[model samples]
Target chain A: MSGVRVLVGTRKGAFVLASDGKRERWDVTGPHFGGWEIFHLKASPADPNRVYASQGTSWFGQLIQRSDDGGKTWEPVGNKFVYDGVPGTHLWYDGTPHPWEFARVWHLEPSPTDPDTVYAGVEDAALFRTTDGGQTWHELPGLRTHESASSWAPGAGGMCLHTILQDPSRSERLFVAISSAGTFRTDDAGKSWRPVNRGLRSEQIPNPTAEVGHCVHRIAMHPSRPGVLFMQKHWDVMRSDDAGESWQEVSGNLPSDFGFPIDVHAHEPDTIYVVPIKSDSEHYPPEGKLRLYRSRTGGHEWEALTNGLPQRDCYVNVLRDAMAVDALDPCGVYFGTTGGQVYASADGGDRWTPIVRDLPAVLSVEVQALP
Target chain B: MIRVVLPAHLRKLAHVDGEVTLDVEGLVTQRSLLDALEARYPMLRGTIRDHVSQQRRPFVRFFACEQDVSHDAPDAPLPAAVATGDEPFLVVGAMAGG
Candidate 1:
């Protein structure tokens, strides 16, 4: 019988939750690097046994931990993430030029074909790649050195490169998203990048339709259909049919479009998920109800999946990296909340169950469906 | 043997129960002691200080003979007591941000 491993990163540590394909009766493992903040944990698609974790703290700084035996054992790897050259400057919150500084690793994306190759999206917003499996990291440099980089400012959460997507159909194509600096795509494998935010509009910035200042919260692409990308912006849930060349608003009929953590279904290319918070200012669910909205036809139509979720007085928020889906038969959906709950739905989003009720406010959730 | 006391988190990370002892070949100083400690426990490299700049992290401090020597030069020799192992050199995580 196959099983699914849910790798969860929380403010305190990392946890591994394992369950058979039945999706019931889980065995929980960690608090792995206890007392440290684990921003993200991901299993390599080519090698499930190789798991990478981004562990750090404000005082202790950043450390990357890798587990070779499927989260059973781990060792600290390289933590050095110096920029490619003399790090120049990007726009500060006050519109003043500020030197680029390394803050923390926000996301880790392992190569789809090689376990030893991984990409890291970091705060202060830059992309770094490691070829010898987390042993060393070098900045990609092209994305940060774009002409518009000087005008890229930090979002409310600090300027962070939070989303990384490698095109499954094209080896040379890759996409990365940065908060306060829209989406960027590299067709020649990080050699050069171009901003792909033609249709994104943010009222907070002076130029609502500027080429690079929109705060994109998250972007998700189904592995089977890499060209169709879905994004949950700071204020709208969007969809791009031509690989982010242009995006159209799909927030139609949802209670509130201001939300984070958008994801695609395991088997269905047109199906997607998003948690609609009340608004940007109110980071909780609308009307105190926790709902996981699912759109079977991509977007413009959605239904609330709230059978086992809290429906009243629940004010916790779901972060951009907190939602994930396992490619198990019948499709298993998982998400973590700020109130320290990890919920799983065995049969798509029809129902829900909490795998672990209390943890240190989950930051990211990734699932691996084993054969 | 030079005695060094690491912060609680570092101690946990290094999996050491108490003060760690290392053999320092040259005159015991903050830089030399930390170099030996990180060499012995490779995981603790960037925790105490930066990997590139090698500057003491803002919240990390050094103490010997109950004196704050964090601002002191990294190459400065330690107090006699610490050098002689009579008083263990302490690496403290400053009491700020919870």
Candidate 2:
């Protein structure tokens, strides 16, 4: 009997929720590194037992923690993330050039085939790769040094490379999304990169449909259809069938397309999920109702999954990295809210239940389907 | 042996139950003492100070013998009480941010 391990990173610490294959009952452990801010925790695809966590605080700076025996034990690993050369400058919020600074790691994406290889997306909007587990990280500076680098400005939440998606069919190609820098895809591993924001439009920027200035909140892809991608942008939901070459508005009939996280189901290539929030300025749910919308036709058409979710007076916001899915039989969908609730829907998106009601305000959630 | 008191979070990270003790190798200046401390507990690096700059972090402060030594030059010698191990050096995480 296999099991599932859900690794949750929160504003204060990290937690692990484990359950049998049935996905009925769960066992919770943690508050690991109790007073620290765990930005993200992800397990390696090659080996389910290997996990990498990004822990930090405004007082203590950043530290990377690695777990070898699932979440049972952990050890501090290399946290040094030095840029390759002189990290110059990117555009400030006020349109002035500001020097690039190393902040915190926003996302940890372990390699699909190698446990030792992982990618770290960080604030100041940059990408780094570590081939020695979490021991060392070296930036693939091409993304940061792009021709339009000088004009890249920080979004409201600071310029952060918060989303990383790998093409399961092609090991050499990778995709990363920044807070305000739109999306970039690297075809030759991490050496070279290109911006793929053709159809993205942001009303906030002076130019609504620029090449690289759109604030993309999150992007998700199903393994079965690597070329097809879905995005929850700052204002609209989008879909791309040409591997991000161009995107089309898929916000369709949803109440309000403004959302943080977007995800695709494990087995259903055309099925996807997004929690619709009120607006960009107001991060809470619309009408104070927390609803999870599922689109069966990939995009444009959606149905609200409100069976077990809060329908009235629920103002909690789900962050961009707080939603993930496990590869169980019915395909388990999991998401954590800013109100410190982790909800699960074992049967697609019909019904839901809380794994743990109150924890630190959840930051990121990742799931590992055990063999 | 010189006594050092770390902040609550640093203590948990360095795995020190109480005030830690360190043997300074050379002239007991602020820089030398911290070098010894980091050498003994490598995990404390980049927490109290930066990895490349080697400067005390903005929110981190240093005190010795009831004197604030955070703004003092790194190479300046510490007070005799701290050098003699009678008074412990203190590293504090400033109470800042929300």
- Relative to the unseen true structure, what is the C-alpha lDDT of residue A258 in candidate 2, on a scale of 0 to 100? 93
lDDT of 1 by residue, B1-98 (tens): 88999988889888898999999988888999999999999989888899889999888998999999999998999998998889999999989965
Please give the range of 10 consecutive residues that has the lowest summed lDDT in model 1 chain B.
B89-98
Chain B, candidate 1: TM-score: 0.96
Off by over 4 Å in 1: none
RMSD of each: 1.0, 1.0
Model 1 chain A: weakest 10-residue lDDT segment is: A86-95
Clashing pairs in 1: none
| Tens-place lDDT digits, model 2, residues A1-371 | 39999999999899999999888899999999898999999999999999999999988899999999997889888888887799999989778889998889999999989999999999988899899988888998989988888889888889999999999999989999998888999999878889999999888788898998998999999988999999999999999999999999999988898999999999999999999998878889988888999999999999989988888999899999999999988999999999999998889879999999999999999998899
